[model samples]
Target: MMNKGIDREIDWRLRVFESLSYPTIILLPDRTIIAVNGRYLEKMGVEEEEIIGRSCREVNLRNYPEQKFPCAEQGECPLARAVHTRSGQSVLLKYHDVYGGEGWEERVFSPILGADGEVDFIIESIRDVTRVKNLEKMYSGVRELIDQVVQTSVSGIIAADRQGRIILMNRAAEELFGYSGYDIDNVNIEDYYPPGVAREIMRKLRSEEIGEKGKLPITRVTIRRKDGAEVPAEMTAVIIYEDGREAATAGIFNDLRDKLEVERQLKEAHAQLIQSEKLASLGRLAAGVAHEINNPLTGILLYASMMREKLEKDHPLEQNLRYIIEDTQRCQEIVKNLLAYSRQSNPTRQYFQLNEALGESLRLVRDQKLFLHVKVVEDAPAAPVLVNADKNQLCQVVINLIINAVDAMDGNGTLTLRTYEDRPNRKAILEVSDTGGGIPAENMSKIFDPFFSTKEVGKGTGLGLSMAYGIMEENHGRIYVKDTSPEGTTFALELPLVPMSDVILFDSIG
Candidate 1:
């Protein structure tokens, strides 16, 4: 019964071998080919009858086994080594087909031992792994480049979809937005902007409101921070292209904080200098007038007081005496103001709230002739915009500007005062604008020259703007006309919070 079972198993194995798809070849211990499957004969382009009994040197690959191919003469061929060493061997091999096309394959060859305790035949099974290896190489190169590019970029680079889903981001972008690229993927850009800013910016871009012929596409925008604060940024975005099609937008972002801060400091310094100059000029004018006018006024007042003491209440002399005394006192007051204007008074710098200064200046001008026919508007922050400055001096600068605006309007137009901190540079700015006939182009440049005036002779000495300019310079700040249109002109007073070191030293001596 056992012998019958063994014979049955051998018959089943032969049937299984013929049904296998993989090419299998058997070689004799003398390195001769004894048999090959139908698939092997097809691969070699030969009939089984012609190849089955041929020597490896005849039917086997001619380019191998005699030093013509890799691993052949070294006795490292899996088939040869498997039989010679009586063990199993596996290797990769390249073969040239009968038609001369190259093919790469992996093969495992094993020695089949006979009952006599010696190798009987070597069986080899082969497979192809070409496509898999090529794919791995391609993917590896791509991955390495992606890592290198992300690390070396400077500007914040971001690539996202229309839905604001972040698809690609570089290190600079990660730092600028204050969010990790990994964390921002798929997040909306709206999450980083003020309520309407993002939408408005997009609308502008689509409408070509920002970029046109001869215009740059660069934009100043406000970005919303994760902490609910808004930060200013300048961004430039270009439509990416791939194979002549619009792929996505690649945006480069620059944080505006530093720029805005520098602007603020410059503006503050300008305002302070203007105030200083105005005051110094006033002081000098006062000193000159007080000595010259006070003497005459004092004589007038002395006579008037004596006349009042001697006159009866019902007498005509009393009325005239009272008139003289009152007029003399008014002259005295005018001289005092002039004195205040002419002298140099060092400013006590501190964190001053801008809104308060603007309010006070407006109130000072509200009842003036210039404001009588003009509509004045104040668009300033509600918060305390702390800036390093001398409060009194800054207030004087604002007052001067309001008065100048009112004068520019001739008491018959609209005046607007706007104040805010330009966060990018950390500087505060106050813009005073008037809706009046714009300054004559020719006169605009000279408007700040000392004693230059366009008003009626007695109405103005043309000293106000010059004084304003001097004050701004002394305080390490700048004041200039930023823009003008048919409707009116805008005067922008840009100041810095802290005076520069040079400014401090110069002011000390001045």
Candidate 2:
């Protein structure tokens, strides 16, 4: 018989167990179900009386009928382990219902001790863990997919902590920075940016005006490579947060070197097209003006010469006739130059050596008074660089460029003429560089425009460059200012090169 206090203690423990939310059961040493809580009855889909006197294995099989061995006999059975160790044992097990649906449960078997510290009964508890397992599996799959995308991306991908320490960088990022994975490990992100740029970027990312809601707008920046070269890149960045706190930043960037080069080429081509149209309009106007002025100027020169011969040297009107003759001759020269600017004569092309033509032009200009104080440097190749172009027109272009360079230097600076062959482009390049004050920025675009002169009034007709430009176009060549800076200026003339074999064949035919 039990004491009243001991019986009440037992009754109170039974009540607590009955009130628990998890499925619980009490088993005798024989492994028979002696007590079952309401939760256990509901979980097993059975009545309390139906499970109370049943063997534990029989009751468990009511819910999971697919077991090939009894639960108490299986090696991994929680109850069997608990019985052998005289302690608690827990395991994850698959349970199946009558409809063949599967579920996961954590089954725990804990021994209940008697007054003499011997195992009398065992308490079994079952907790469902199916939803948690499913969620873990889904999260793992998503993480793996995101990693794959980042690794295979064409644009550079970088991730850094809030303190700007590099945590992750993709292969494309390594290629862009010219650094390998081992080199950038744990390095500060500022090491890859131009000085102070990383700090400024972080400041902007934290500001609402530039970055809001953790997202930054796409922008362009210059980043430094490991080779100490700078590259332009377009980048977009975003802040990553963990549990409502700022965590890290991620950026995606694309190298802009190729894109910028294409844009520059397009701009140059467009500018050339516009200049060509303007020159065409000016050429038509020049042709018309030259024709209209030629007849009147010719008649003025004829009548002035006739009157001058009739008048004696001592005649008072002789001096005035001389003046008229000189003025007429000046007008005729202007008309002739205008016709040349209009390209009234077609070029007769032939294969000629560029170095020979440059030498002759230099010889002619070196003796002129304007070049007396200027030093000319020739950097021509030892071998002849042959081009299929009009020799006279090319020489004339060379002389005009030299004169202009000399004038720019005020006849007291160095003028360098260089000739070389660009085999890949099949062209011969002639460069004229002067150590003079560079062309003004505002005047650069109009340098090839007809009648657009930077010289003083009456000093230039502004047709020299326009005429050179026309002659080059007719010969399938190009003339352009290569560079201009405060230090000096360089003009380049490119003409199509002819192979020596072709030149020999043409000479034999002639």
Candidate 3:
């Protein structure tokens, strides 16, 4: 009865061991397989009798001939290690199946100690880990490729976790923000944005009304740099998802400083073209009107002079005749000015010193009633600043600018005439500044337009600035408002400088 009870207890233990899911086996210290569960026999496709009393190496060889030796000869085998150390040991190994297919498995050996505190039997459990290892390798390769793409992109890329902590910042982002030695890890994404901007962006990215499918449209924003300078950027952002849940947010930014500058220059050029076209149209109209009025004014002047001669000395009508003659002469002068504005006579181009031309213009206007009380200051360079332009046309431009400056000051403030050379550009610059209330903003754009004048009627014909603008253009020069404020206004004239070699050659020829 004692032997029967002992046998039943051993049978109950074997039944419990066979019910386990994993492929499990029991081995003696000699490395002989003493017992295996149904799971092991099913997995190996072999009957229990074929492996029960066989050595572990012999059993492995029957199933996987490619594996020459089992745990005993294999270096650091889990079963051998378990027995030697009298503890649990685990290792990964490669094995082949009955159909000549290979895969990986993790084998764990737990040594069961006897009363002598020595390993008596070893229990081994095998788990397939081939799919898990392959997944890890694929994930590593994909991560490396993604890193390469982000690092090489021209547009800056920034990625942050759902909690707004920065996770990745590409090299472009570092350069855009002027951060070369700054640490970025765990830094909040809001720190890179201006006040309240990051939160607003995230809100737009999350709202379907503002964005589409977790993506925000490209928009302009001012981003503060590491040095506290604000830079304009065009940005597009999207929310990243992993396993159907929100994972992170990523933004792509393009610096717009260069692009915006290019756009501004194009706009300025377009405005200049439009102004030129308008001036050309008005010039044709002025020419026609001046020719029609010139003959009548000449007839009137001749008749008024004859009538003045016909009047007796000290006669009441003599003074009236002189007044009529003087008024007709003034009208004739106006017609001549109109013809000049219409470009009836082409410019006779010549090289001349800009300061001399300016001086001539100032002398012509110095005795005028409008300039009698005004202070005139000249700030020309000591050396000659020569320009290859028509001297008479330049004189007209300088005279018109000076008279306008005097009128702007209402005959009380200062008029400054300055000449300088832009050596790098091979050009000469003439600036006429006035200490007057600057041009009103509403009139600034129309100041050069024909018939657009700020002066009271009869005080101006509104053609002075328009004529000056045309003369500068005809000479291949530029005229623009250099600076203007409530305090004053400065008009600049840029003309091409005559080279010293050309001047010397012309002098020798002369």
Candidate 4:
């Protein structure tokens, strides 16, 4: 009858038990193991013959010595409690894994009661939870790393909620905006930007035209600091979203004051380079014109004197011949002056720069009403081109030329002033160009003559260019018309460049 009842119990419960997910073990009421699933044998590294018909504790102790629970001395175990209560119970168990790591398993005991309500058998199922626990640990480590990065980044970082309440800020953000790490909750992100700027940023963040959706590309904008002073900055931003809905916005800002200053300086340097190139071309042309004019003027003087010598004494054209000789002499003098001014040394001249003088002169006259409609452009080189001249007189010469240029423009046109080194000739060139009706061809020869005025009598002293000519000679420099056309005129000044090896510069470079 006992055999029949056990067979009936096994037939009812064990029919579909092999397909259960957890590893299973079955034992009789006396604690002798009767059956074990394939998973149980595999998990324990033991065969069914080693566990079947043997005391469960004995089988466990023989296979896994570390699992030996002293049931007699200790309180009643989970298995014993399930047996006494004639019900199912579960207790979490810890075990040393085969790889020497610790792992967890939930062991559940379910008793099978017979017709007399006596516990006939116990079935235990084991569920391992080690992989889940490891995954949780990994997630915890990754979260900590992210928090550390947010707090320690080098650029300013800030975040706000949908209502513009400041939610997060890093240490860099505090330093950049001149704020301390206190009462951040009271600060509003809108305060960091000029009025309406913060709203514009949000609009850009939501627009896909600039960057991808929910992002703002790096942009240059003005930022207002805590002290209310505006500052230049570059910023990038992104909208933080949850489940495809706008949640918040975050931005990274970097101060651009120093960077902008550097860019301004670079532009100035580039302008200087352009002036140098223009001067190089001017030098080549000036030299060519001087060489071409000097030889022909000397030849004319020689042939005309030979003709005067060949004339008969007291001839009918004697008086006219004398006038020709005298006029030719004057013409030769003028030609000499036009080609090249005297290069003889002047003991009175001292080293100075057209760069400073021209700049000062421009600044002095640019604000005048005469220039209200004029576009003034300047290009001055980095290296100072020292000239042996009087500083004040050079400044006056620059002022005179600048006024002449603007007057030529008739109150509205571009005026370009440039000063650069003509290194090969050991000279510096100052060029002033004007967009105006050019000097007429007939008036060109008489331009530097004294008291030669094209303007109305009261409107001109008539001595500007002639006085500039005298000053150039005194300063050991050359002044001439570089080019003239229907479009405009450009005047060139060639001043001696003091060599670095000769001048002992106290501060500035030679």
TM-score (all chains, Cα) for each model = 0.44, 0.76, 0.75, 0.44
What Cα-based lDDT does every candidate model obtain? Answer: 0.71, 0.87, 0.86, 0.78
Mind giving the per-residue lDDT tens digits that candidate 3 earns over 253-319? Answer: 9999999999988987987899899988877988899999989988988888888788788889988
Candidate 3: where are CA atoms >4 Å away? Answer: 1-127, 137-145, 185-188, 203-215, 239-248, 306-315, 351-387, 409-429, 433-435, 496-510
Error of 3 at 330 (Å): 2.6
Which structure is stronger by TM-score: 3 or 4?
3
Residue 275 local lDDT, model 1: 52
Query: Residue 64 lDDT in model 3?
Result: 66
RMSD of each: 13.3, 5.3, 5.1, 13.3
- State the lDDT of candidate 2 residue by residue for 444-491, as single tens digits: 889998889988999888888988998999999999999999888999
Q: Which window of ten consecutive residues has the lowest lDDT sum in model 1? A: 63-72
How displaced is residue 182 in candidate 3, in Å? 3.5
TM-score of 4: 0.44
Tally clashing residue pairs in candidate 3. 0
> 133, model 2: CA deviation in Å?
3.2
- Report the Cα lDDT for candidate 3: 0.86
Which one is best on lDDT? 2
